[model samples]
Target: MEVLKERFGQIGSQSVYSFTLKNDEEMEVTVINYGCIITRINVPDADGMIENIVLGHDTLDEYVNDPYFLGAVVGRVAGRIKGGSFELEGQSFTLAQNDNTNHLHGGLKGFGKVVWDAKVMEDGVLFSYLSRDGEEGYPGNLYIEVTYRLTNDNELSIHYRAQSDQKTLLTATNHSYFNLSGNLKRDVLNHSLHLKSSRVLELDKEFLPTGRIMEVNDTPFDFTKGGTVKRGAESDYPQNVLVGQGYDHPYILDKNHDHEIVLKDPESGRTLTVESDEPAVVVYSGNSLKAEGDFRGVPSRKYLGICLETQAYPDSIHHPNFPSMVLEKGEMYSSVTRYKFGIED
Candidate 1:
């Protein structure tokens, strides 16, 4: 383990620090203290050329103020809440209304905006944060610990552990936008995407789940067999058009606890395989990126990088049919997700 030297002076007044950890195979990862963000991950392609596959700005100030959710850890609760409210047992609760008619990404101040305490160990780096009761209009005083481990075997593993003082929902994940080709200038539409999900949690016009777990068999939402992201995106796919752009719904993965979704850029020979223990994954195609700003990506228009967010189903707190996201007093809630990189010949 070596402490990464801070060469760039723009890390800001937030006491930024970087750590490098090498796994058994000799791969290296650079992690920063601010937002507990993974600043850079260097991996080899088919030609043995190492490249940084994740998108990010050069300074802490950009992430500190950016609302794009780029490469940042999300949640107290990761997805949307219908009507920005939910009932627990028999009590009705109102959440912060960041979205016009719903609660989006834990309201105005999410875990992404908070600075986390960092600790460097021989294996990797650990970042911790504590959310007070009703911090974002949610119950429970939640304590969260997230660990990032970069292994020599080409895997960037993330472990999430949380504990709540009261009964409250928990769904946390890292929102990393990846363009594996190392070309920020190109759209990811050419990349082939394969999901292990047979069904998707249907969402309404506003992107909230309709509480129905619809089968993806005959629908365009089916990515189970693998296909280019743009295949159904241009067709008359009902879910496609309903999402307002590309993917933004939570696909119910069909793996036995730990399954993977793979994406490969044939041109760049870069591949990304995401494996997780979390029950569901939210596949968002950066549809909201076209909002107009410097954050509009390098060259391509909208639908550039694809997001595979592993977590509990969206609006789980409001849906009784969905798996429980509840963390009762003294109970520990934990999950793991990994992004493994390699080249396909």
Candidate 2:
């Protein structure tokens, strides 16, 4: 294993640094302190050729100006919070409404837009940030740490730890648009997706959870048995019509003792297995991703990549049946999500 650091750029007055971690399998991951964003991920394909499979910008300036979240760590809350207000312990707190009429991904300037204090490890990098109390209308001084590790076995592990001075809501996940074909120009619609989830959170027209948990057995949202992304997207189901573009709903994962989801690109023979302790995984098919700049010299387009974001259910604060997103004082919050990459035999 090897670790290398380079000056990425300056975000405001803060100097951003990029840390590169390479393992024996020739897999390399570069992460920048700014938003703890993953700048690149290089892995070998079927032909033994290594290429970056994750969507990312060429420079720090592009990332700063990008809105798609690209390859950054999403936080405070990973998904939508309806109305941008939630009552906690008799107090009603309202957050910044950044996504239409809802509060999306923490707030206007969430964790993804902030600089974190980074520490290089032998096989990974640890990023720490302190979210001040009342920042973005939250109710606590929260301390968060996110560690990205690349193991020799071709696994990228993301570990999160957080604590708040007061009761607050917290959920975090990595928003990495993956194109296993190693070609950003090619859409991921042809990729085979298998999710170990039997149900999904129903959403309204605005993309907020409708407080309904529907079964995926006979719906287009079903990926229990595995199928191509295009097959699901082309289904004439009502949910598909409501979502319009592709899979953006959060699937309720089955209780499994192994990885919850698998995505494979037959062209490159590359497979990605996602395992997480979280209760749900939001499979976003990059429906609205039309970035202005080039991604590694390739033009960015819609459906070119997909995001399997593992975290708590969206709007969990309002749904009592869903797993809680509350982080109380003196309690340690921890979660783990891993992505293992390999070529199918």
> lDDT per prediction?
0.78, 0.89
State residue 63's C-alpha deviation in candidate 1, in Å: 1.1
Tens-digit lDDT track for model 2 on 9-104? 997799999999999999999999988898889999999989889998878889988898878898799989999899999999989999987898
After the best TM-score superposition of candidate 1, give how far the Cα of residue 315 lies from its true spot, in angstroms: 0.5
> TM-score of every model?
0.92, 0.98
Model 1 agreement with the true structure over 1-345: per-residue lDDT tens digits? 444435333344656666666665545676666666666666767777776676666676777777767777888788888888888879887888888889877777778777778887667889998989988788888999999877656788899999998898888888888877764646777788889888888888888898998998877778888888776567577788877657888988888335468899888888888999888989987766764555334643477677889999988876889998888888998899988888887
**What is the alpha-carbon lDDT for the whole of candidate 1?**
0.78
Q: Point out where model 2 deviates above 4 Å.
A: none
Top lDDT prediction, candidate number? 2
